[model samples]
Target chain A: EPEVTQTPSHQVTQMGQEVILRCVPISNHLYFYWYRQILGQKVEFLVSFYNNEISEKSEIFDDQFSVERPDGSNFTLKIRSTKLEDSAMYFCASSEEVGRNQPQHFGDGTRLSIL
Target chain B: GESVGLHLPTLSVQEGDNSIINCAYSNSASDYFIWYKQESGKGPQFIIDIRSNMDKRQGQRVTVLLNKTVKHLSLQIAATQPGDSAVYFCAENRLTGNQFYFGTGTSLTVIP
Candidate 1:
């Protein structure tokens, strides 16, 4: 089964520094999403990308965050200034299409540690 | 029975026993629900899902039961094993969008 792939399984960065998380979604998937799970908390949606543009975003995704489909297969999330609270497990997901019933496949995740 | 806690609620079951994890969703407009399993330090793995139109859906070793009237969902694991020990979360999809609201997970511990 094809699955989403996330790079740099673990990322450590200083607070206020920029960080870009990379993901390679399934080849045929049309929708890509980014979600974060803070330690001991529920997984939270960050943003969803379709057609090279953001379709939806949660309040947790603020001005410091942005997502881009840099190429056909690669989706990236950029945080202009990382904060200590940003430390969490960031997951990348891909779905065949965008709809309420479409199931999203997830990658193992990238553990971001903001120090 | 459910209780609120700062920690993930833990359920312990012996191997080969059946396990049922319950979830209560907040949105009445959610039409689709999914159950995911997350191992420590890993992303959520899709388990099974059910649409509001259906009351039950079965997978390999798991079954999802949806009670739309009460906004409740449950995942049942048959013949549970050590490999099934993980955090289980239920997520609900809005009637019109792609955002999934995840429930606070329950930790399943299969004692060998």
Candidate 2:
């Protein structure tokens, strides 16, 4: 089955540095989302993007965080300044459409580690 | 804030036995619920989902039961196997929105 794919399975960056996580959602999907999971915690929603604009974001997605669909296939999340607390497994998901019947499919995830 | 949560942190079942995982949500507006399974080092994989309008839905060897009055959801796995051991999470969402609120998780260990 077609699936969402994320790049840089592991990312290590210094605190205060900028980091960008990339994802290629399923080709036919129209809505994309970003979620994070702290070690041993539940998955938390970060942001949702559709039609190249952010639909909604959580408080955890603050000023330092931004998402962009630079092209048709690539969706990226950039943190302007990384912090220790930002370290977690970032997952990308995509759904064929936004509806009760359409469930989001997730990628393996990018493990971000801040030093 | 309203949240989704699991009834237990861990459960153990023998191979060939049936396993049931339960979840509860405080948000009455949440009309859709889904269960996901995550193996070690992997992301949540969609297992099954049910809408508030339905009380039960079944898939291959799996059944989801929803109790709207009590705001409870349960996932039942028949003939559980070793490969079925994983951390399972429940998520709730309103059909009007696109975001999903996830529950902590339940660790399932299948004893060989």
Question: For each of the candidates, what fraction of the native contacts does it recover?
Answer: 0.74, 0.64
Cα deviation at A96, candidate 1, in Å, is: 0.7
Chain A TM per prediction: 0.97, 0.97
lDDT by residue (B16-92, candidate 2, tens digit) is 99998889876888888899999998889999999888999999999999998999998999999999999999899
For model 2, the stretches where C-alpha displacement exceeds 4 angstroms are B1-7
Computed on C-alpha atoms, the DockQ of candidate 2 is 0.65
TM-score of candidate 2 to 2 decimals: 0.96
- Per residue, candidate 1 scores C-alpha lDDT tens digits across B1-112 of 2323314388888999998888888989999999999998677898888888999999999998888887788888999999999989889899757988898899989999
Every candidate's lDDT: 0.89, 0.91
The true-structure Cα RMSD of candidate 2 reads 3.2
lDDT of model number 2: 0.91
lDDT of 2 by residue, A67-87 (tens): 999988999999999999999
So what's the TM-score on candidate 1? 0.95
Q: List the residue pairs that clash in candidate 2.
A: none
